[model samples]
Target: MDAQEKIAQILQRLETGTCTPQELQWLQDWYDNQPALPMHTFRDEAHKQQLKTGMLQHIHAQLEPPVHVPVVRMRYGWQIAAAVLAGVAGICGWWFLNNWQPRHKMILVQVGTGQQKELLLPDSSRVWLNAGATMEYPQEFSDVRTVKLDGEAFFDIKQDEHHPFEVHTGQINVQVLGTSFDVKAYATLDETQVTVKTGMVKVLHEQKGLDVLSANDQLTFSRSAQQYMKSKVSNQQISEWAGGMISLSQAGFAELALTLENQYGVRIRFNPAEMKQDEYTLRCSKQLTITEVLDLISSIHPVQYDIKDKDITIHRKN
Candidate 1:
């Protein structure tokens, strides 16, 4: 690749938290070797200075924190060199870095209510995001394979034993070499859950190892109680949501309410009452409308529901 192409690749890897030590050193060296140019080389000083500042700001804004990739330091007098090169090199340097490099920046995907999306990560892993879920990843992944998650998603990670894959939910971290799993860690919920469908995974909290789990293993961490529960889950139970189905067993009102809110994008409110059912069993299609789901749910219990716009209310029936 040409210098511009190589630089773009390096920057992409940097943006994705995958830049290697050698590539980083090369970037530093490239900046260090820029020939100093006199101020008069540029057409206008004020205009050049303004453009330079804007370009740097834009580049920095597109980058993740320096903790992932060290910030490239510009040598003294490099500003004039940059301005002159950008003007004389037919938009080869700074201009190219700003415009052409954006293709490699961080990317965010969000699914709204009553919708779902499937995506392929740079590492060839597949992800299915449920409604009201959001995930952020890079346009390309290099040495590191990682993504940030919120809400719920099912991941089929590609294998790269040398570079383990990681999913970050604010409360916990899931790491795997190659695995298919489902993660539920919606910010509005009181617990985060991980259910493995294949291979193995390690779950951590606050940078400390919590537990290592294998296929058919489920780990639930309660945010409020700061406790962990380990259980066995069926493959159907783990992959049902991805198949547009909702299956619950012995689930309480809060769990059911959150599921409805996520799938339907509605705010749910319950009256003050005992909301737990000893025989709480629910199975339905996510294709059902909010009203239909409510109807089905109420038929199994003595409860009433009302829907107004995006808000839903559930109360015990007398």
Candidate 2:
């Protein structure tokens, strides 16, 4: 048989605990004669030993118990058997590097201005990201489903009571199990809001639990003041942005400007001194062009707007 075929047969025998002593010796000799694998560098000696022990232990657990081998030789036989398994696992050189390596790949998704995105996570959870938002998640979730968000997202998580889902933002961490919720935690905005539409959510700050919210419940945390307020919200307002609509109530100039920037993929520049502290309540369709929305605003309030190719300037009418 060819060298690879012979090696495969030997490994198969070894895995099944049917390798004779002579076959075991021959396999050991083959491994010794083969070229060494490209060694993975470790941070420290202790870390290296720790990983080695873990791999060997895992491989050993999968192997069938040795048969017809003397008790005195069991220890040495098992060690050699594990080494053979490791060597076989390194067949393509790539498998060993990827599987035996101690790193988990993380993926980052960024939504550009005026754009929205939808993702189905490994756990079958669905997320809808708003414009000007970014999210980070591991390629595969572990014991706990965790994701980081820098803007706003609506999450409909699948039920897994054993593995609670977590959303980490700037000011707060939200934990849930099979729930639908919306989180608004833009870095530009001073306040972080967590609103639940269904199921229960637990919000925490700095590892301390802030409040538990149920359906139609909202928790607002002010970053600047380091304060928390829990209030009731209408279910329709929970994730209205995801449905091609923008709604605001008692919103300030900055909030309005930010919403416009994210929705239109434009930059807005306005002088705070020239603008009044007028709170605007707007419910408009996201399909409206930047100029159209600005015109609508002007009709309601006496304000002049200048639009120049993805940039807008607003000032109070003199």
Candidate 3:
């Protein structure tokens, strides 16, 4: 095979979860043969089962050959049961081939409304996406660990000293060697919030070419101000979004309103005076409806609201 075709074969193996160390030489061979080829294109579940463990049998069947082959006897001499299970495993193997073909799946996981999802990346990293959040990644990571995220996600990244993970969101670029962190970058909001939970993070503002973030730090990049602010973080406030709670400590009234609008998909207006405030603190549950939040605000402060269709509202709530 030509260099290109050979490299393509190695890539296919890498993507299909079948590549072995012996194949490393194949990759090097492809590279060595690159002089004769074109430049390049940069590229690239758990179950429990026992007896009545149909899932395992199904998975096993998927690897069986089309033609019948000689089989070994079971140590327990349960040939009858083994035969039945083998047939089931065979059918499963076919089902996997036809329906579950890996064909380079770009897996994206997300959550909406009162839902949440936990995902395990091919690199053994973990991600928890909050409601109205999403993560897009490949079925297998290449030389680099790259992902695109929107809304909010908590990442417990796997330590990879060699290749750091990069998170691309809205207008911010976050890179990390290995750390647990949270990011909130919804388009509806005017700012993207990055909070470092452990280790260090580097936040880059793509527009202005600024990088800001480190261990135990909180960073906010504002679209309106076109500025970056860094401060020692009180992690709890920044990470509340991942817990289905919005805790805005020292958040401006306008910022608070913006967060509410984005999370609930509603536009709210506070009596002009409220918007003029420099800041305010709010701790509200994500599960609460906008009306409930407003009601709570009304009880605590001299506030009233004109709710209309749960879509838009004029509020005097403090």
Candidate 4:
């Protein structure tokens, strides 16, 4: 087999726990033989940031207790395995995206933290997701091109008048014939929002029935609003997060706190949950300083926060 194909097989073997100790030794030796590549050097640029976000997770997996150790140790080999896996994963991602012809009807798309992923559905529709997002679909489009999403996703749907595309987000459902839209349905966010960039969409709240939204229309449902509020959205306001942007409308302090906690990999808690009702807007993307985001929110609402290591606490301005 070719070098790339061989590496791919080895990586799969490793993931499936089928590689023998001797095989692992050879794999490790392969990696150790090559000069170490700085881990940070692999950070994907701009559109490829999603790959960088999950680097830590992959690294952790490397340290996982091995199923077995080889009787003969290859000097300076473990690093080689890591390097090989990295190369294979990069190749696999590219191959998967460019040459996607899987026999399965449904394909699953998963992205790691600080990671963003984009997929072209079986129906020729496109979907982009923010950090920590996942999407699952049939390998092939049977009767419908429906997908289940957790976290957030921006879709550029292909025009299919016969079989419309539908996205199920636990509590709500968004359906479109041929429309471009974005959906943020994280439970942490009191409200779920779907902004239509093009065409039209039908937003159905199992609790509230059908809400139709046209192009440039944004439908926001919050814990307080309880009903769909249709509003005009600035061009490019939604789907910007896929480009490393953070866009939140009518966002509360509680939500902001959670985002900060997620971004920095820290924890920030508020004394009274109600205090999070203070609404604000934030933009922290593209070389923007994180401190600016924190300071901006603090200016609007009088709040006190205590930083205990990576954990933070916020209390009312008392």
Candidate 5:
């Protein structure tokens, strides 16, 4: 067989997890000797990266068993590199496929009200799904690492320089190679926000605009105004929710209510319309129960709350 054909066979064995160590070494040597191909060999730069990422991830998976790490403790750069390697691996496999078949199996992770969940992707990327959030991803990421998110999440992505990790929300798309960031894009909210804690993130709003953010940078896109605002925040602690802490600075009552509902699994109703204008700056620890939180809020604001089962009603104090 020709060299190209031989390399293809080796890659097939790798994919099936059947490649002998000798075969793997030969494949590696052959790859090292090959000339640098044009980027156009794949559909786009992103696709090219995805292929590289996939290959690297496959290699690692073969060489080492998966290591389970807390989502918050994962190494940011390594996660990104792993994602990029996956892309490269995918490209290598795709090039040899005579007839490609799509993988239809998908995985959906949903966090119920007042609950949070942690997920580990096949590529070793970690995701923390906040309360009342849902994430949809493929059982196995092939070329690219892409996920659809509704509500909020904090991602500690595995690094692969070639592939980009993309999180799609209703109002915006957050893309990164390897980064730690929080994305809040609930459908009910008028604004979608992305906060970067480490590395860099690219936030896209279709044809409207795009914003690239670095550590401690935040981007907010207003769906109603179709405008984006960028700011540097001193408190990167917003992501602390993943660790059972809630911090807010001059946040409006509506936001506070939503947060409480999500974190406590309660339905909160504010009466007479004026409560929406109420704002507060506060911090709550996980030790505080939902009732305690409401009590704390009522102590500061001119409001009283009545809790009945899972429902809460707040009214302006007379």
Candidate 6:
């Protein structure tokens, strides 16, 4: 059989899942080798639109279940090859316009201290950016969907099995097909944390797979030690900040101070170093003012605080 007939048979087998791994690899190699059509070559807007529609229709048909059709003989191998390559070029051109073009320009979302924001990505995925967080994403996703995050955010990714979603945070990467998760990776903090709420995610550090997390799973990577810890957490408790709630469980004074600072946009100072070691468990709504929250903290612990403008000083009570 000629190359065109062989390729058509292989494609049919691929659709039916009967193609061998080697055959699949061969097809991929062939596609990768095909020359891409230059965008400048399109003569007019109408011509470009026509080609896009045809390519999209062809792609959609391939994705659907196979239908029986009689094979038509072609006289010249070169003619059949040219026709196939032209279709491939049209597909490439469509993708270039829809995906690659938007990536040249990125959109940035930055949440200042004590300010939180919500974002809707090009793929309709939702993101809740926490205080002092920054996220950068393309105007549209290409073959791979990726976003860069600094600080913290909660993501509810739209499902797309063909294109996986990835979040890049400093040294670590969180990857998923479709899932809800929270990531905290402050540059000043020694640890980076990822908490999964639904579906599954793969955590990678320096291109190496560190762990796979399912619903309620949490992964903490220590920057100083270059080690990671994985554990289970209450999924409902994850990303409580998104709901305007601050929840802590047996958290130390240092951590509490950090949380308060981020939530209230204040600088906290401890009078004594020993106070940093103090631990407490608490939950409070963001609706309460910083003073009220501190009062509650004082009631629970033997401490007093002085607030002056945006600065707070905490001291142990005698």
Candidate 1 backbone overlaps, count: 0
277 in model 2: Cα distance from truth in Å? 1.9
lDDT of 2 by residue, 263-308 (tens): 8888999997777467777889999988889998889877899888
Q: Write the per-residue lDDT of candidate 4 for residues 1-318, one digit (tens) a residue.
A: 544455556656665545444555565555556554444443356534555334324434544546574343334446654554555444434534433334234667777655677787777788898766678787766445678887788999999888878888866889889989999777666777789988899988773556889878888877556666788988678777878877776677766765665455567777656585577677767345445666666776786666777777777776
Better of 4 and 5 by lDDT: 5
Better of 2 and 3 by lDDT: 2
Tell me the spans in candidate 3 whose CA falls farther than 4 Å from its real position.
1-104, 207-209, 252-278, 286-289, 299-303
The top-ranked prediction according to lDDT is 2
For residues 60-145, write the lDDT of model 5, one tens digit per residue.
65555345622222234345434434344543645444213233357888898778899998789999998889899886675568
Q: Summarize candidate 1's per-residue lDDT along 1-318 as a digit string, tens digits.
A: 656678777656644646554564566567556666444443566656765565444434433346665664433324433443343332334435444545457899999877889999878899999888999987766455889999889999999998789999979999999999999888877789999999999999988988999999999998888889999978778878878888776666887888888787799998535565434568898878889988998898888888899988887787
- Model 4 ranges with Cα > 4 A deviation: 1-106, 207-209, 223-226, 272-274
Model 2 whole-model lDDT (C-alpha atoms): 0.80
Give the per-residue lDDT digits (tens) of candidate 3, residues 1-318: 554345456445544534344453444433444333222211111221232265334324433324565544223323333443433333334323433344246888877655667888889999888767878887766557889998878899999989789889987988888999988887766788888888888888773546656667888889889888877867666567667787776675666666666577676766556556455567888788788887776676555678676555545543
lDDT of 5: 0.76
TM-score of 1: 0.69
Question: On a 0 to 1 TM-score scale, where does candidate 4 land against the true structure?
Answer: 0.61
lDDT of each: 0.76, 0.80, 0.65, 0.68, 0.76, 0.78
Whole-structure CA lDDT of model 1:
0.76
Off by over 4 Å in 5: 1-102
Return the candidate ranking by lDDT, descending. 2, 6, 1, 5, 4, 3
Worst 10 residues of 1 by lDDT: 84-93
Cα RMSD (angstroms) for every candidate in the order listed? 9.3, 12.3, 14.6, 15.7, 16.5, 12.2
Candidate 4 pairs with clashing backbones: 31-80, 32-80, 104-139, 105-138, 105-139, 105-140, 106-137, 106-138, 106-139
Residue 196 of candidate 3: its Cα lDDT? 88
